[model samples]
Target chain A: MIDLLYFAWVRERIGLPRERVETGAATVAELVEELRAREERYALAFADLSSLRVALDQELAEFDAPLAGVREVAFFPPMTGG
Target chain B: MRVLVQAAPFDFGAEAQAFADGAAGAGAIVTFTGLVRDLSGALTAMEIEHYPGMTERAIAAIAEEARQRWHLIDALAIHRHGRLRPAEPIMMVATAAVHRAEAFAAAEFLMDYLKSRAPFWKKEVTAQGADWVAARDADEAALGRW
Candidate 1:
């Protein structure tokens, strides 16, 4: 099981802050595809890949990055800090 | 280097004084504070959300980069999360260096990275409603200068 976290509007759209997903996906992109296929809320939150950023185990990563041995995945819009 | 992510309001004056005093050979110290702006006059508060573990790590990485690039004597970053009222400070960055140029540049670099690279999202709460502040393209462009 992979721990998934969502923030900002993605969390609002998905109706939760975090979840534990059991998946066999091989990469971040594949995992996104799996989530997108699950429901309409997931589809809407992930509809635009360009607007979203992803992190694997607390580090920024590309969509196609391998997820083997990864424990946490986060999805959110571009940061507006500072 | 010190990075703090918290919901409590920080004492800017005290922090600045402490930072300046702690720098052993710093010829210059630059500090920048970002405040919640009520541009529309209708804004009641700014809500900031951040990824718990990643926020600190990302900020530390940015500060580390600034230190290495500018040969900084020390660096400090403090960012607040959760609900913030207009005029309240949202974050602050301070850099100490042997020269004013390095201090200024390092502070700017830290701000630019913190704006785009850090995992913090801001939502403006106005009397009308609440909306997430969209990431500005200009902010991303600012990173190219580094």
Candidate 2:
């Protein structure tokens, strides 16, 4: 089980902030693809990866990075907080 | 070091006084407060959103980096989340150092880092609808130069 968090417009699009997701994937990109396949909301939320940022275990990472042992994955729009 | 991320607005004068209350060694206290601008009142309101745990972690990291860069005695950063109207105070940074230069520099540095590095997004509610302010390339460039 992995905790997936969404923020900003991503949260609005996904209609959630966090969720316990079950996935059989080796990389963050695969997980994203799996999510995108689940529903239209996920599709829209993950549609534009260029404008989104990802974090694995609270460290910034690219979507293609391996997620073999990662416990958490967070997706959010371009960080506007300062 | 005190780092706060909340949805409710904060009191600047009170926060500043509390930080400098009993610190006799500190010779200078510098502070910066960011308010929601009118911008022609085009934006009647704004909603600030942020990731929960991640938001706090990012702000803490920025504060830690600032402390390492400057000779800071005490530092504080408070940012509000959720919905806010125009002219509201969005954020505040306070730095105390032995000299004015260090205090000023650290405070400014913290603000700059927070603006670019922090994981917060704002959506302006105007007459039409909600719009996310595009992350300024200039802001990102500013962060890179630091």
Candidate 3:
């Protein structure tokens, strides 16, 4: 199980802040592909990988990175915190 | 103690005092408070939106990364969400270390990471309409240099 989080327009597109996802994917890219396959909403949210940032297990990572042993994956627009 | 995310405005003096008050044998406390500037030539009220739980976790990770990369004794990062007025405090970072160099360097590092790595997004509302501002190349370059 992994806690998937969405922020900003991604959250608006998915209509969810967070969700518990069960997956058998081997990499972050595969997981995103699975999510995109689920519905048009997910497809729209994950359409452009360049516009989004990903964190695995609370650490920033590339989309193609492996997801093994990861407990959390968060997706958000490029940060504007500071 | 290391991270806090909220929508309410924060008092800089009080927060710095509190952080300094909690420090143990620290000689320097460097703080950075970012204000909502009416972007040069732009008049807009910005609204910051964020993922509740994930935002905190991402910032904590950035703080932890800063701790690992610097000689720091303590660090605190607090950011505001929701609507914010021009010139209001948007975020603050305090880094306490044994000397001024570490404190200052860590403070800068923290802000750089916070700007590029955190999960908060901002939308500027002007007389025209609300438009979400995308991340700039400068921010990416800042993160890259680290």
Q: Which candidate is the best by DockQ?
A: 1
Model 3: how far is B109 from its true place, Å? 0.5
Q: What is the lDDT of residue A67 in candidate 2?
A: 90
Prediction-by-prediction clash tally: 0, 3, 0
lDDT of 1 by residue, A1-82 (tens): 9999999999999999999999999999999999999999999999999999999999999999999999999999999999
DockQ of model 1, rounded to 2 decimals: 0.97
Model 3 lDDT per residue over B1-146, tens place: 47989989999999999999998989999999999878654656889997666679888887888777776888999999999988999999999888999889889988988887777888888887777878889987987767
Once fitted onto the true fold, the runs of candidate 2 whose alpha carbons sit more than 4 angstroms away are none
Query: What's the TM-score of each model vs. the native?
Result: 0.99, 0.92, 0.82
lDDT of 3 at B113: 85
Tell me the fnat of candidate 3: 0.83
Q: For each candidate, report its DockQ versus the true two-chain complex.
A: 0.97, 0.71, 0.64
Give lDDT per model, in order.
0.97, 0.86, 0.87
Output candidate 2 Cα RMSD.
Answer: 1.7
lDDT of 2 by residue, B1-146 (tens): 89899987788999989989845689999989999877766888988887677778888888888778886888899999989988889999998889999899888788888886788888889998888877887777777656
Question: What's candidate 2's i-RMS value?
Answer: 1.3
lDDT of 1 by residue, B53-104 (tens): 8999999999999999999999999999999999999999999999999999
- Score residue B116 of candidate 1 by CA lDDT: 97
Sorting all predicted structures by DockQ, with the top scorer first, yields: 1, 2, 3
